[model samples]
Target: MYTLAIDLGGTKLSAALIGEKHDITQRRELPTPASASPQSLEYALAELTGHYQGKAHRVAVASTGIIANGVLTALNPDNLGGLNHFPLQACLEKLTGLPCLVLNDAQAAAWAEYCLLSDRFRHVTFITVSTGVGGGSVIAGRLLTGPHHFAGHIGHIQADPHGPICGCGRTGCVEAIASGRAIAAGAKHDLRGKDARAIFARAEQGHLQARQLIARSAEAIAQLSASLKALLDTECIVLGGSIGLAPGYREQVEELLTRLPPAFHLPVYPARYRHDAGLMGAALWCEYCAT
Candidate 1:
């Protein structure tokens, strides 16, 4: 059976039609509407769903928000504030006339990568270091979601209690120091451009300030992975997202990680499905729900 997958990110809403083999047949993306209400985001998703009406047997969604108790909370960018306590599954089912499954973006990404790389490792940790740092795990082929459905919310793990303030108002969280947003902010003074790619490019070109900013960000991520390794002893840690997969960034992250305590040593790899991990993961969830 075919599945419809929707990935609701902070900046965009992407939808795709997927077959059982996990190949995407059709896809579309649109800017997420700027509103704080769940209704607003739902309207955008509803419009996108119309494009795939009757084309798939099931629907699944991966969203960038805190999901708990069957409700979506902590919609970021301040544009999706209305999503708090939103009945996302019910609303989508009503709009599309199909069964709907919702999973946190990080969990969906973990499942996608696990499906592709489980053969290489028995236990895996999937970390996405983008606008925010988020992560998930697959232990013995089972998705690891905690009681609150916030199991993979690793971005808030306190790294430095006095470093930088995160959007969540926490001090020195991993995301505050290592995410794409953090990288951009840290390089804003030396980098003339306002984009992450621009800052990364400058760092690649050996710009001293930009290089230091990138190194610092990479260090935070490596240290976090090291901590995870010491705790979970996972076989592999997979890195994805815009910043994590950047050409030179991964090497730098590895270098920093290698300098950590030997007890935290573990292999780190880039995500197999760098760009489409979320969509594929959402589709995987559709199959999971069907059974």
Candidate 2:
């Protein structure tokens, strides 16, 4: 049976058909609606799912934010344009006419990555540093979603007590400093209004300020990695998302991780599924649950 996998992110929406073998096809993408209205997301989802009428037997979604009881509550409202409390699973079921399964995007990715590393590590943590920072962990060969389905939100952890306010109304969160949104928000003068990607390009050109901005993000992630190791005793860390997989970002994080004590040192590998980890993981979860 084919599973319709959807990845909902701050910047884009993607849907694909995943075969039982875990191969993906007919993938489609659209920019996320910039509007905060619920109707915008509904329409966008309808349009996205409309492309495939009978392509799959079940729907699986890996979405940003907290997914509890078939609903999505955005911790950082800015990430999803202020959309919160959206009925993600119910809406998708109605659109696709198939039972839906939804989970935190990063959590879903963590499961996919863990499956790949099952033979090597019993404990693995996956972190994504894109629009916002997020994380999921596989501990003792099981994915940890916690009781409230909010276990792996590493981005909300405080990196600096006096740092800038997060969109979630918290102060000094990792998301406020290390996320792509944070990187863009931190820009000034020449880099003002530039997105993270543009700043990264400039950084590659030897722009000192651009390099500093990215370095700040890397620093936060490194600290977060160390904290995860301390808390979870994860055997390894898998870094994902656009910023995590960037040319030098992982190297920077590895270097910073080296600054910690030997106990905190763990190998940091790039996400093998890359950007599709969320989608693939969601599909894998669907298959796992459906059977």
Candidate No. with top TM-score: 1
Q: Across residues 141-185, which tens digit of lDDT does each residue of candidate 1 receive?
A: 788888878788788889999889888778899998898888787
Clashes of 1: 5
Write candidate 2's Cα lDDT for 11-127 as tens digits: 789999999789999999999888857889999999999988887888999998899998988665555555788899999898888889999999999999998999999999999
Q: Give RMSD to native, each candidate.
A: 1.9, 2.0
After superposing candidate 2 on the true structure, give the runs of residues whose Cα lies further than 4 Å from its correct spot.
78-82
TM-scores for all predictions: 0.93, 0.92
Off by over 4 Å in 1: 75-79
TM-score of 1: 0.93
